[model samples]
Target: MMFKKIGLFVVIVIVVLIGVMTFNTFTNTADDPIFEVVEMPAIDTNAVAARLSEAVRIKTISTDVGDPPASAEFDQLHLLITSAFPLVHENLKRDVVGDHSLLYSWEGSDTSLPPALLMGHMDVVPVEPGTEGDWEEDAFSGAIKDGKIWGRGTLDDKLSVFAILEAAELQLAAGFKPKRTLYFAFGHDEEIGGENGAGKIADLLEERGVKLAFTLDEGMVIVQGMMPGVEEPIAFIALAEKGYLTLKLTATTEGGHSSIPPKTTAIGKIARAITRLEENRFPAALNSPASDMFDTLAPHMGLPLKAIISNRWLLDPLLVSELGKGGATNAMVRTTTAITITESGTKDNVLPSTATATVNFRLLPDTSIDDVVDHVTKVVDDPDIKISVKQGNEPSRISSKSGEGYQLIEKTIRETLPDVLVSPGLMLAGSDSKHYETIAENSYRFLPMRFGPDDLSRVHGTNERIYIDSYVEIIQFYRRLLENTGG
Candidate 1:
């Protein structure tokens, strides 16, 4: 009788556990609002593509060192802007900030409401030396073939710069002005550190006592075959971007012959330090941006994934561990360490007195530079190794998805691309949006264009291009966004 009663209780417990999991999975659906589809007005897409191609042809390249490049290229592009978009140049008050950076203000009817700002960079990284031959079209040709505009800046940025101007020009033609103010910021040196361009612009705006409702800069995009379990294209609207920190590590010891080394050579010591850092990674968790993303997309996923995601209380450890497996997804969870540059002995046969390595870290939103320094110190516990930060910036603040400006952008995406699911995400890399934290109430990072898996390498790689239709879609998305702000 005791055995039978115990078996009955076990069976009941199993059934209840299953019942709870099933209920949670079913209820964990996306809270997507139904949006009415918008009809796009006929646009001269050919003209738009031609304009973008012209912009790309100008070699407005920026480098890691000295740039807001003192060249005639930026001047030529500025001339094109003034000539091509007559209405925009005539009406929107334009200011030349930080040498080559451009800022345009379109005064709205109402002065009480804070403004919305859109940003893009005009600078493009130079084509690598030997790889120039690998391109299907000339690197600066701006060739339009197979329904694509091929060039360096076409994807990395020129699209946003042209798209915003095109949308504003179109709206101005229709005699429509925003009720809330709008600003267009075009940074000239974002390819580098952006210290001279967007950074200065932010300072200037702050000095003027201008606070924004929101600011949008290009970062994430609509992607396919990237997120796990979801097959369709989903848009990642990055709520925050990862912080950047680069540390230079050095080791010093008594010089000696390679055969007659001390207890450990400098090279070996630094190498061991780097290996320790790689092996012992930062703790992983399904934090916001990632956590927010999963919650939004959970309902769209398969049953197993949905169950795992919804029942995080029971399965967070397993789920978080699995998330750290993929290269791209792994960056979404914890601070990532990468050994970029290393230098050792001049003559391989000689034991070097000093060895050095440069390591880069992309910190998660919650992680600080000092926190990273402490982690490295603890992990690489050798007193012989010295660590110093070369350059660093803390992560951007997480913007609200429920904010009015975010919803305005979200609704625009829904209306323009009705089929794509939009979700909050974390940007793995940096952007000019980092500088606008103080001047803007919230900052968003997204470009409404479809990107596939392989398109990742094409940005600064060979065959950099943007689809003509995609370019048109970007223009329409911005137009819809600007129209939505006409309260």
Candidate 2:
């Protein structure tokens, strides 16, 4: 009789668990929207591509932080903007913030409505020294070939600046004046820290007491074949950004010859510290933006994965394990550590007296710089090693997935792409959007550009390019966005 009771109890427990999982899985899809691709009027794709190509050719490369930018190149870019976008130049109020960053304010019919801001950077990172040969075209040539525009800034960002101005220019030609004020910001040093450019712009806006209703910049993209289980393209709009931290570690030890070396030299100590950092990594957690992402994608995913994600309350560990497998996906789940640079002995035979290493950490949203310092100190367990923060910031405050800024952007993306799925994600890298988040009610980071799996390495790597048709879509997306907000 006891065995019979036990069997019945087990069966009841299984039934209850299955019932809960099924409920969660079915309800996960309540918010998914289906839309038919709507037809739109055509633009001159060739002319737009030519303008983007011309913008890409000018090298407005951002030097290291605190260093002066390329003045001549930026001057050439400004001239191109003035000449290419006569409507925008004539109608908008332009301010050259911090010399290179440009801010344009377009007055609206109703000044009482809070203003909307659109931003993109004009600067591109320099091509790696030895990898220039690996590029299919000259890194700065902006060659239009094989149905694509080839160059550095073509993908990294000059496309955004051109797209915004082009969209506004077209809208103005159509005699469309916005109901809400609009601001266009083009920062020149976003590739570096953005301190002198976007940072100053944010400060200026704050000084003027200009409270922005919303701000949009680049962080996520419309990606294909990157996420598993979903066969269609995803418009991954990142609502939060991982914080960045650079820690410099230095160690000093007794000077000695190689033959009379102590048990552990300075270099050895630093190496052990790094090994400790790597081996004992930050604990993985299925945190927000990530959790929110899976929840949004769950409805669109395949069978077992969908079931698992929706029931994260019961299967959190399993979901974390699966998502933590890939390098890109792993970044979404936990803080990442990379030992970028190290220095030790001056000569081969001598024991080094001093050793230094540079460590870069991308902090998860819940982790702070102080928390990292404390963790590293405890894990390394070394008194002789001195750790100093080179530069860092806590993760961005999570933006609202349901905010007006996000809703408008999502609507614009859905209308623009029609077939793509939209989901909130965690941005793995930093962008100029961080600086502007302070003054805006909500700041969103999504570039309307579509990227495939193979395109990931090309951004700051070789053969960075954007398709001509893709550039056309970007212009369309921005135009729709402008129209949605106030055009």
Maximum-TM-score candidate: 1
The superposed Cα distance between candidate 2 and the true structure at residue 219, in angstroms, equals 1.1
**Pairing residues by index, what is the TM-score of model 1?**
0.97
Model 2: residue 275 alpha-carbon error in angstroms: 1.9
Stretches of candidate 1 above 4 Å error?
1-10, 67-70
Give the TM-score (vs. native) of candidate 2: 0.96
Evaluated with lDDT, which candidate comes out highest? 1
For all predicted structures, in order, the TM-scores are: 0.97, 0.96
How well is each residue in 1-487 modelled by candidate 2, as lDDT tens digits?
A: 9999999999999999999999988888747655445445688888888988898889898768877899999999999999999999999999999898999998889889899999999999999899989999999998999999999898889999999999999888888889999999999899998888899999998998998988999889999887888988999888889999999999989987998889999999999999999898888889888888888888889899999988988999998888777688889998988999999898878999989999999999889999999988998899999999999988898889889888888888888898788999899999988898889988888997889888879998899999988888988888888888985
Candidate 1 global Cα RMSD: 1.4
- Supply the global lDDT for candidate 1: 0.91
Model 2 off-target regions past 4 Å?
33-38
Please report how far candidate 2 places residue 115 from its true position, in Å.
Answer: 0.9
